[model samples]
Target: MSTPTGFMEYKRQLPVDRDPIERVKDWEEFHKLLSEDELRTQGARCMDCGTPYCHTGIDMTGGTSGCPVHNLIPEWNNLVYRGLWREALERLHKTNNFPEFTGRICPAPCEGSCTVGLIDQPVTIKSIEQAIVDKGFEEGWIVPTPPEKRTGKRVAVVGSGPAGLAAAAQLNKAGHSVTVFERSDRIGGLLMYGIPSMKLDKKIVQRRVDLLAAEGVEFVTNTEIGKDIPAKQLVDEYDAVVLCGGATKPREFNIEGSNLKGVHYAMDFLTGTIKSLLDSNLEDGNYISAKDKHVIVIGGGDTGSDCVATSLRHGCRSVTQFGTHQKAPLTRDPINNPWPQFPNVYTLDYAQEEAKAIFGEDPREFSIMTTKFVGDDEGNLKELHTVQIQRKVDENGRKSYEPIPGTERVFKADMALIAIGFDGPEQTLAQQLGLETDRRSNVKAKYGQYRTNVDKVFAAGDMRRGQSLVVWAINEGREAAREVDKYLMGSTVLV
Candidate 1:
């Protein structure tokens, strides 16, 4: 437990972000770190409730309520508050394999369920977690700890995303020879490309990758499972195979003129920009340039926000974002979305903040839908046709959207990026491996057991559970590794 009077004595505070104008000029992380004294004060704000729902790792109100990885939140918070930084780092690592990644990318459901949040603001759990890990790295505390002896068991992990990496790390700790295969030229699947560098620096991702390599996890990049190597070969060669190739099949718009030259899938644009920037610092001209173009990003999720920010960095002339649903309330609606569950509230994300700073107003427009892409004579996107929508519910409780009459309008756009969410895992490898799929097209695998229909084959992460958070992926990976270890050695000690 932290100081008994800390909650009332101090208020919640977070690290200050860099000036929007200054940060938009380059691809660097925005938030500056809080000083040690301030961090301790934040840590002391933790009440350490008897129930401690912050680490319950459960679902509430159609979304996650707590840390899916079940981190020891209160213990670490107390440790940090007591100035035991090293011990705090160890406690954090007990459950999470990648605190740095989660600290940066995760939406932090743990904070949503914080006991302290029942009345006042939530404790700064995410920032404290990041600070612990960052201090560990600066003081040379994080190092490779290879297994003492090899179990002589071989495991093949398909995909180098969060889940795959977590599974590989755990399996190697249990003395299994682990090999991770990535289709991209570099590892860290989504971490490398799906997310922008400003949000999560590539150097931090690569630093962990390098450490994993030192710990004896083999990485084979630019290798597709069902394409470069046969899926059957992995099952035949390795004692066990774990699939974590993330859900990547983008949902189709199916509207008119979607195939225009200047229109592209959000991942393609994001991946290309990151790859080009990493390879030659954007001098290679290998990515889609939004410079001097009027950009319209369809969909108002994290990806759409990322697109808006990336476009601004590319010097886009103007930007707009479309959302099918209405914007959430500025604060939690007590009657509708009460405490302990993630509040469906409107907040300015990094990109939206930058857009507001540069463009004078927020770039998002809610309760709108893009009807079609209007193309020029050269087959390039010239404009977007959109309409305002209103929700209607049928007697059966099914909901649908209807375009409001007299609200249809056209907006000029030189480039349009679709950031609508993914459907499920790409079916090529799963189909080739003869794995069963759910109605949603996700690979068929039980949650706790993580075993697919096929013998010696297991699945986890987005491939098994559909598109989800990095923390959930890590949880799936850790649990799946334990099950795989038991299946291989008859019993296991992995958690």
Candidate 2:
């Protein structure tokens, strides 16, 4: 342990975020970094328990318990505490391919499972992680170190998201030639467009892409497999193919008047705004506008919150988010939600924080479900019908949302954004390659093996495992690369 009583002596602290109201006016990252002395003190707060659960990386009760990437949390914390920052960055790179991304956006399940969290707050792990990598970059310690030799093996990676990028990076490190194919006009699939800029700046995504390119990983954008190029052609040409094209099909909210003019999927709205911002700083006026309009975002989680923030940035007259679940209590329920499992509690995320700062209250409506879209004669959305719901369990142990009588309500809305979630990946490529898929429409592949039914083909990340965090995607990608390397060389040195 760095210090015997460090945990007791130093209470957990995180850098204060930029003023939410001021940050909403521009599209930039809102987080600030703590000074070196403060960061070292925060790192010292790690208990470094003999039985640390922070890096266990297990699932419990349908939620993650620890870091999915299995980060060496304790070791890095000690290193940072000792002022060995470069060493801390090196240890961080051992597992995570993109700490900068995860440190910024990941939910930090690791903190929930921390030994210290059983008593006080957990170590500032996520912030320390970001600081380590960011410091590495600023000090010029991170650079492109291409393989000393090439193995003469060629690998094709589908999708340029977290999984695909990590797979490509690992495969290239093993001296394999990697070509990443992305359908979008740029690399970093979800990282580039799906998320808003305020959350993850695009430059961070591009910097990593440039490093991968320098390390001899080729990236091909604007070309989709199974469409612009034949999926079979890749299977035939490359030594091996790894699919990481993520679960992209947004779940449909089919209700009365669902096809109204002002109703759209959450991804569509987010993607358009980002693309426009990157292309011309919104000067082209090619994206959705919520200005001077009352907007309603259906569903909750990060996407719904992002919609709320984006609408606020557009100067929306008012915004409200509808969530299917009840309002979470301020603290975890010990009996139902035990210590190790991620705490299901009420906390304002960045977007909601911005909304509250601007509107004087959080704009989330819990335990509500939208019923139908009330539209005008021109089929333009005007409002949405909703009813409060309560959770009920039947004799069979199946759960259902039961509507409560006399709780029906309607809210005026000029635009409605569906941000529920995704179904699975689009099936065109899988169908074209004659690959099997699970019932969920994810590519059929064993979790550890990542091998599809087809020979020399593998799937990883959300495409194989369904929608999940970026850390899990990186984990699957790294593992899948190892399997691919073994398949190609009849042996493997990758981990």
Give candidate 1 regions above 4 Å deviation. Answer: none
Worst 10 residues of 1 by lDDT: 54-63
lDDT of 2 by residue, 362-446 (tens): 9999999999999998889999999999999899989999899999999999999999999999999899999999999999999
| Local accuracy of candidate 1 as per-residue lDDT tens digits, 47-120 | 98889889988877648999999999999999999999999999999999999999998999999989888889
Which residue runs does candidate 2 get wrong by more than 4 Å? none
C-alpha root-mean-square deviation, candidate 1: 1.0
Model 2 clash pairs?
none
Write down the TM-score for model 2.
Answer: 0.99
